[model samples]
Target chain A: MKVMRETIVSTARELFRSKGYAGASMNDLADAVGLKKSSLYVRFPNKEALVPAVLDLTLQETFGQRDSASGQWDDEFVEVIEFIATTLTDRGRCVGLHLAYGTSDETPIAKHAVRAFFQAHRDHLSSILSRAMPVDVARDIATDTLARLEGATAFVAIFGEKDAMKRAVRLSIEEAKNAAAAKSLSSR
Target chain B: MKVMRETIVSTARELFRSKGYAGASMNDLADAVGLKKSSLYVRFPNKEALVPAVLDLTLQETFGQRDSASGQWDDEFVEVIEFIATTLTDRGRCVGLHLAYGTSDETPIAKHAVRAFFQAHRDHLSSILSRAMPVDVARDIATDTLARLEGATAFVAIFGEKDAMKRAVRLSIEEAKNAAAAKSLSSR
Candidate 1:
């Protein structure tokens, strides 16, 4: 049942990515997963319940990359930064969550997930920033940096190409490095 | 009639920000500015046409800010870097281009404006990078920087607060400045 459930959710996510929420349908999701519409209901009570789960998986996977790096800059903090940047980029490409959060406040599921995601983002960045900068500075930078990254992704999704997206990531990471260094300098 | 037409588009932009694209309608737009539906049509062909014009105006204002910055940092290429960061920080606060452009990808109006935006972005960033770093590195950084900003913005829109967004921007700009400085040193 769990394997079947995962299949349904993953299929729905793929549909949502390729087609906007309005463009996709429960029937389509069911067809994509090789299940009857009724069977899909067995796993997913409805489109609303199912869509968030699909997106949640993607968000978790994208942010989850923090633990998986190996290279010259093996510091845990550096890896965290890299993971965050990649997560943002990946959201656009893989899940389109960056693009599809909502059409408005009425979108409760998207709103809930987005709010939760930001909360996690704030906590994660706060931890990193506190280590490298004053608490206030860290929090400010964290809020602004995350907001900028989100905006950038939205832009790239609408108008930017692959190369442009990649460039944004590189510069952002470099910025994090500079911030860390500057904090050390000022504190010393 | 043209004045009324422009008024409708202009007012719609504001409503879109607070009310969101999906939330507002032609009726609400008309009512907001004290006009009837038929009169509103004199200026805007439909909900769609009005959206683009309004978007253009907002984007124009944003780019306008870039043009008016202190002359000390007004060099064209350098300004593009500044533009990327600025756009990331407050795009949602604006009411035109981003709203229509970011809302959905199907609109032809958004398509043209966004394409033009990206083209200018590439040209400006390319020139600046060529001047400061090896062509490849410069190009890579420009694209990377844009992506990070976009990604960060997506994160903010989803999450609401923006600690991460602020940090990323501050850090990214500093890094870009340093990279430019280093390139100048090497040239000397």
Candidate 2:
């Protein structure tokens, strides 16, 4: 039963990633899962209901269970940014970002899930940045970096320019390093 | 008749912005436009056909017919970034970007329209930045700045952080100024 449920959630994630929320129908999910519409509904009451599960799974798969205690801030930040850039620009689509933008206030649960994922990402980035700069500076840079990465993903999807993400990642890392170096220089 | 057509296109743009490409159906558009499905088809042929026209109108409305002849690169760049940030984050949605992300390879015409819009934006930014720095440097900065703004829009929409756009705008402007200043110092 657990395996069956996981299969449905994973399949739904792919469908949502490619077709989007409205584009991916319950019938399509059922067909993809090789189950009847009734069976799919029994597992997930509706399309919106599946969103939380799908997003949770996506968050886990994309970010994993890694902690930010690596103590190597630069390397860890690079790893995170690289992972995101690669995943987001891989097939020229970011399922998480796409779904987040597509979600409306009408789907509060889905919106909450989307918010949670982004917040987690932001928090992760802030923690890493704080190692090299003031807490507030870290927080602001983290937010800015995340936003830049998200925007670069959109550019990749729209223009098919994978270098856009590379540029964003490079610029973000350079800025973070410069901030850290500036702090050190000032303290000296 | 032209006014009615304009009304339909504008309404469709709102729907696409709010609900995304897959979410906004032909039936919904017809209902919003107070036209029968057949009537909507008569005007547009199909939902996909409306994408190009809607995008063109959106580009015109969002960007207008401004040329980049302004020698004041810093001010001009700021204006463009501020305008994009305001329009994209207003109401917490960017119709052009949302449509672009939601577009699929199957919709070649729609995809082309999205690419063209972003390319025009990049070109505009590049032209402005070239006045302050070397052309190559200006081009890279323009691409980087635009990605940051685009990413900031998604952050604003997802997290409801209006400050995200403000921060992006400020950072972009600061970076452009710093680059211009550096070039002057080195040349002297």
lDDT of 2 by residue, B36-147 (tens): 7778876787788788888788778756866657447787888888888888778578777777877778888887887887887788788888887899888778887888
Q: How do the residues A55-99 of candidate 2 rate in per-residue lDDT, one tens digit apiece?
A: 888778766866757658999899888888888888677677778
How far residue A59's Cα lies from its native spot in candidate 1, in Å, is 4.1
Chain B of model 1: TM-score?
0.66
Best by DockQ: 2
lDDT of 1: 0.58
TM-score of each: 0.65, 0.90
Q: What is the C-alpha lDDT of each candidate?
A: 0.58, 0.82
Off by over 4 Å in 2: A1-3, A185-188, B1-3, B182-188
- lDDT score at residue B119, model 1, on the 0-100 scale: 51
